[model samples]
Every structure is written in structure tokens, then in C-alpha cells.
Target: MKKYLQIVDRHKASLGTRFVNNFIDTIILLIINFILSFISAVIYNVTFIHFFYFYNNGGFLWNVFMGSVFGFVYFFFWENFTDGRTPGKYITGTKVISTDGKKPTTRQIVSRSLYRLIPFEAFTFFGTDGWHDSMTDTRVINYKNYESERQLKDEINSIGVKETA
Candidate 1:
């Protein structure tokens, strides 16, 4: 733990989970989107012709626009509200903070999301940890301030309220 902190202190960066809980969050979002699509189809009275031709042209464009807007807005709002988490980050118990030890700005969120559009992600083999960290000029941190997070969880699960011995 001390080693991790020390390394961070020296390098201005720290180790954080890279798997990105956004996949799960994205699944949830996809469901929401699916529902929305159904509603749109019903409300717009989009026929098979529209569905095949003009349907996606306008619908797809609107969906992408809305999704981008919502993503940035959600990120900025939640990162400020919970001290740096999207729904995904909250679920995963992680937060993003400025790498320079400052709070993230709205601009950072926009830039971070946009930067993610680049193909630099493919440049890395396994995870986009480095790319993301660099893009936002931010680093993800374990939500718990104490290093005993894991130990505490283990203790709670390992013992019962009653004493056996």
C-alpha cells in the first residue's frame, strides 16, 4: 500500500482497475435505448419502409447525438456529485481525479470522452488504462481512502456475529 502511494507520489500517477465497469453500464444503457427505440417506433408510426430507408438515417443520427450529449453531461454531473464517477464508476467503487492532484473540470470530461474516440486505444494491447489516464489528465483511484478495504471485506465475510470458540 505504501509502495503504491509512494510510486504515485513520485510519478504523479497511481494504479487503478482498468477493466472499466462501463460495459455493464453500457448494457444498462442499451436496454434503455432499446426501450426508447420501441417507444419511438410506436410514436413515430415508422413503417417497414421508414424502418428500412429513412428510419435509421434520422434515428441513428439522433441516437448518436443524444448519446454523446448524455454521456458527457452524465459524466460531468456525476463526477462532480460523487467526486468523480459515472454510474459505472460508482458501481465499481472507483473515481477519476486529476493526475496533478486537482479536481476535474467540465472541459476535462468533454475532452476525455472525445479523446477516447481516437484509435489510440488500439495501440495498447490489453487495457486502455494508459490512454484514458493520459487523455483526461486524470487517474482512477479506489474510492476507499484506506488501504484496508480488501482486508475489511475479507474480515466481514470470514467471521460471523456469534463466536464459535
Candidate 2:
């Protein structure tokens, strides 16, 4: 667990970039949601006055529940496949990773995703503040250098190139 919470290289990302990524991701998701809802309504034949009233009145709670569930499902499916990136993180070239330099475990991914609901990782009590930013002890980092160990390999390759030339 401690290894999982390790900090990322400071050069990889900034707080500002993290913020914009989140904002853009949210806007894109909102647009997608609107499109889905429109499709649902159309398929249900909500063009007629009676149909609109019946569907809206009958499925209000269910619709909200399904929407919430869909959000979680979307995050889980995409994040796992994309190496901890949502659309926002992907656009910003950032991702979450364990400190120990390994792909995250299934439990780790789910926990981290749930922890994201902590509202910017901020909390307060007893006249002080606390952050869940370290919940995973994992750091948000630029994806490019996620594999720092690769630097050594690149250096070796560079030396080989010079010798061959």
C-alpha cells in the first residue's frame, strides 16, 4: 500500500494541467450524456404529448439511477483499458500509476477511481485541512515518462549508435 502511494516525478505534470484535463473531460462527458438521453427519448416515441408525459413520469427515478451507473461503468471500462486514463487525462497526456513502477492491480484501479469522488481530494476538520490526494499515494504524472527505467535503455541504445557510426 505504501509503495502504491509514491509521488511521481515533479516534471511530469502540474496542478493546472490536471485541472484543465478534468474540466475538459467533464464537458465532453456531458455532451455525450445529452446525446444518449436524446436517443433514448426518440426511441421511446416522446414526440407525442401523452408519450412524453408517460415516459418522463414513469421512469424518472430509474433514468437517474441508470445514468449514475453508466458513469461508473464508463470510467471502469475505459480507465482499465487505457492505463488509468479517461478522456480528460488522455487529452492532457497524464495518468495515474502506482509508485512501484508496475501496472495497477484491479483493486487499486477501483479504489482510486472511487477515491476520485472526494472532490479534489480536499477535506477539513478540527480547523485544519486534509487531502485525499495521497489516498492512493499514487501520483498523477505525464504519461510520457511513466516508465523512467526506460531512460537507462535509451542511453544504452544511444551509446551503441555512436559506436556503430
Candidate 3:
């Protein structure tokens, strides 16, 4: 596990991968919001006429605020259930892990999600460590590489020690 953590820390996702992750996640979140709005409209029997109006006439600040709240919910639930891989991260073959090389706790997920609300948080990805990652002591790693390496290591260690699973 320690060695796997080392691999994850060293194999942090690149800026391009991170960008793709962000783009994919944003689109997913938007879709989720739309679905929820549709459901609410159906419940009201409004047929979403007001929904379109809200999107078209909503204030910029109101949109931003709701987006942030939505983002928090989106990130928290996905990371928690998927063990740190959001839909975007899963598609990119990446995952969020603690800096110490363990699964993140609920607190860490909450902190990371909230930190994402920071203004221009995406810009922080330009640096080696993203703001949400650095603040929460987490990293987004290339899980494909990490998982393969971990499996290889386990195989080697089991040689002559135990029966292969």
C-alpha cells in the first residue's frame, strides 16, 4: 500500500488530463442540473416553461452561486461513492487519493469539494498542484498506471510465497 501510494504521488495526472476532467465533469453536472430541473417542472406541471426562463433571465451571481452549490454536491457524492473517482476521473482513468496514499475520508472529500468553490479554482491546475488538491492533501493520479503497477508488484511479491489468486 505504501509503495502504491508512492506510485500515485509520482504519477499525478498532467495538466491536459486535468483539463479534460474538468470539462467532462462540468458537462455532466450541467446535464444533472437539467434533469433535476425537468423533474421539478414535471412535479409542478409547468412543462419547464419557467425552467427555460430561469436559465435565460437568471442573474449572473445567482447562476454562479447555484453552480457552486451544485458542484459541491456533484463532487462529494461521486467521490464518496466511487472511492475518489468522479465520472470525469473515471473516464480519464484517474482518481483522487490522499497525499499519504490512502482512500480519502469524508472530511477530505467535503473540503476538496468546498475548496473548488474558490474563485478561479480551475486556474490553480496550471500549477503542479491544484488548489483543491493541495489544500486537502490529495492528488489526482493516473489510476490506470497505478493499478497495473500495483498488480504487478503484488504478483512479484507472491512469487514462491503463496498460491496465485
Candidate 4:
């Protein structure tokens, strides 16, 4: 239907926009990680006697596990608490929503975050949607479209008109 197509077009974010959002988010996360690592190094140097044994005995597996945990927590908490908008989404004027154009449930948000762990998931955006979105039945939509939809509904209601869509 015309309405359905229009809604889909309005809600879908362009691939360029998605790429930019991801780039910005990655940069921000990297900066934060760098600062934390610097602080840890300074602390370790000051308390060398206490942490020398643990610090020298490094585990690659532990590092990977902690990285995954950090990524999960960062994405999950931001999207869940911010109405599906992370810092990157906020800056890019995009937000995650259910396929039906509503806020996604907590489970959907968590699934979307976890799906990011998929190897080469970034390439999945070359298709219709990213793996995270496709798997979770969610979409990252333009906030402008969402605001316009809300205004339209409000106007219709004020005039006592029922919208079919």
C-alpha cells in the first residue's frame, strides 16, 4: 500500500548515516578506553609491588572476554535506557524501533546488542538491514520521521479524525 511504503521509506535510515553513527560511536568508545587504560597503567606503576604478579601474568582469553562484556554493557544500557537511542544514534538523529514503528521491548534491545557480536556484522548492512536489526525485528529510524508521525497523530486526534494507518 502507499501508506505502508511511505512509512517504510520515512523510517529507514540511509546506509551512510548508519556508517557515520558507528564511526562516531567507535571513536568515542576508543577515547574512553584509552583514558581508562592510561589510568590503570599509572596505578599499576605506583603500586608495582602489589600488582606485579597479576599484571605480568596476562591472559588473552580474559582480555577478549572483558572486551565482549564491555561492549555488551555499553550498547545494552545505552539503547535500553535512552529509548533505543545511543550516543551515536542521538548525534545522528536516528533511533531504534520495532518493525511496527513502536519502541522495541527490553528483550528486543538486548537481542540487538548481542547480535553486534556477530563476526563481520557490519557487512550485513549491505543488505536490507543490519543483522542486529533483522534478527531482533527492529530498525534504526530517523527521529524526524518519528516526530512528524507523532505530530500527525496529534493533529488528527485534535480534529476528531481517525487515521486508518
What TM-score would every model get versus the actual structure?
0.59, 0.65, 0.80, 0.80
Show where candidate 1 strays beyond 4 Å.
1-16, 46-77, 119-128, 146-165
Clashes of 4: 0
Q: Give the Cα lDDT of each candidate.
A: 0.58, 0.61, 0.84, 0.79
| Model 1 clash tally, residue pairs | 0
What is candidate 4's lDDT per residue for 1-165, written digit by digit as tens?
111324644678899999988998778777776676666677778877545434334477755665667778888998999998889999989998887767789999889889988769999999988999878878888989877986897787789666587
Predicted candidate 3 versus true structure: per-residue lDDT over 25-138, tens digit per residue = 999998987887666656556564665556545788868887889999989999988899988898999999987778999999999999999898888877778889988888
Superposition error at 142 for model 1 (Å): 0.6
True lDDT of residue 107, candidate 4:
96
lDDT of 2 by residue, 56-130 (tens): 455767665555566566666667788777888888888866666556666766766566554444222122212
Looking at candidate 1, the ten consecutive residues that score lowest on lDDT are 1-10
Rank order by TM-score, top first? 4, 3, 2, 1
Worst 10 residues of 3 by lDDT: 1-10
Superior by TM-score: candidate 2 or candidate 3:
3
Q: Over the full model, what C-alpha lDDT does candidate 1 score relative to the true structure?
A: 0.58
